[model samples]
Target: MLSKSHLKALSFIREFIVHEGYAPTLSEIALGIGIRSKGVVHRYVQALAQEGVIELHAGRKRGITLPEPNKERDMTLPLAGRIAAGRPIEAIEDQVRVDLAAFFIGPGRFALQVCGDSMEEAGILDGDMVVVAQQEHAADGDIVVALIDNEEATLKYLRRNPQGDISLIPANSAMVPMVYAAERVRIQGVVVGQLRTYGKR
Candidate 1:
């Protein structure tokens, strides 16, 4: 069994790779896990390599790599039970599996990590990953990734006025909406789902 430190190191490496699109160096790993000793970090890496949890490439500075996930395994979780968000309810067991792949994976679907709190009221916080469906057109009130002037991109609620102006509305009440000419805004994608990690990110 892997110790707590091993798990923490593994988790950090995974997150770093997902965010940066490459493996982190030993020093980066040490910094990420709050350890001061590169020797200790090297030992942890060697242990993980011995356990077949990661691969190490000799002569490479950033050689750590996670094994590929088994594609045949179903991406699902047990439904288990349901809980109320408001009123109290009786707990009941469920026998269903929630197929995450069905909901989040499809042609033209992609995910983007949120970077700001502009959509907090809509339950999309900073650091959350939003699954988006690629499309060029969106109806009014759809939360979408909008490209402005073919340059800057932002996530907001799409709104159209009779005057042919488009408004990019933020979920936060503290912020005002941005108005643009209809021709200046391009619809990139609509948000379909979202995911967030609970603990240390």
Candidate 2:
């Protein structure tokens, strides 16, 4: 966790580096953070460096630099309003950040690359990466990754019949659902989110 002053200094340094194409000096950072003492600003900078949020280079005029952004975590994107999927609608600009970490990263969460079209009708296509929340159980209607007889694994919708039987349902109409004894099917995880890539792999 970072204090308010630390966060402010970090924000200023980031914005300054982005606009100026180089890191700011301690004096510049002091001016940006509305602080009068260089020593105080240096203490904040040292603290940020200790936290691994920024790096310092010895004997350089502009020594501070931010680390590269992580690709697999803590990513955010602008939510620039909605578009109609069925009909034409007016475009409106909206300023909002969609934090990808909140949706895909969490305790016991993992991702699996989809292999088949069993879930095509559910808008989950082959080759898509599905994020799963690992657990031993799931609701009756949840799409889940299941281990069958502890031998084969598959993705399907879970259904519990009144007779204590389980059904692994597929989204494609061309395929039939698999019925198994409740003891034969082990719920590995539940589908939480998905990712698809366009163009060359």
For candidate 2, write residues 1-201 as lDDT tens digits: 356898799999999999999999888999998999999889899988766779899999998888767723344444333322111133243575445543354567666666667788999887676777879989989988877777567888889999999988888888888899999988878988877889876
Give the number of the best model, judged by TM-score: 2
**TM-score on alpha carbons, each prediction:** 0.52, 0.53
Q: Model 2, 117: alpha-carbon shift in Å?
A: 0.9
Model 1, span 127-190: residue lDDT tens: 7767778899999999988877875678889999999999988888888888999999889789
Q: Local error of candidate 1 at 178, Å?
A: 0.4
After best superposition, candidate 1 residue 22: deviation in angstroms? 44
TM-score of 2: 0.53
Question: In lDDT terms, how accurate is model 1?
Answer: 0.76
Extract clashing residue pairs from model 1. none
Question: How much lDDT does candidate 2 score?
Answer: 0.75
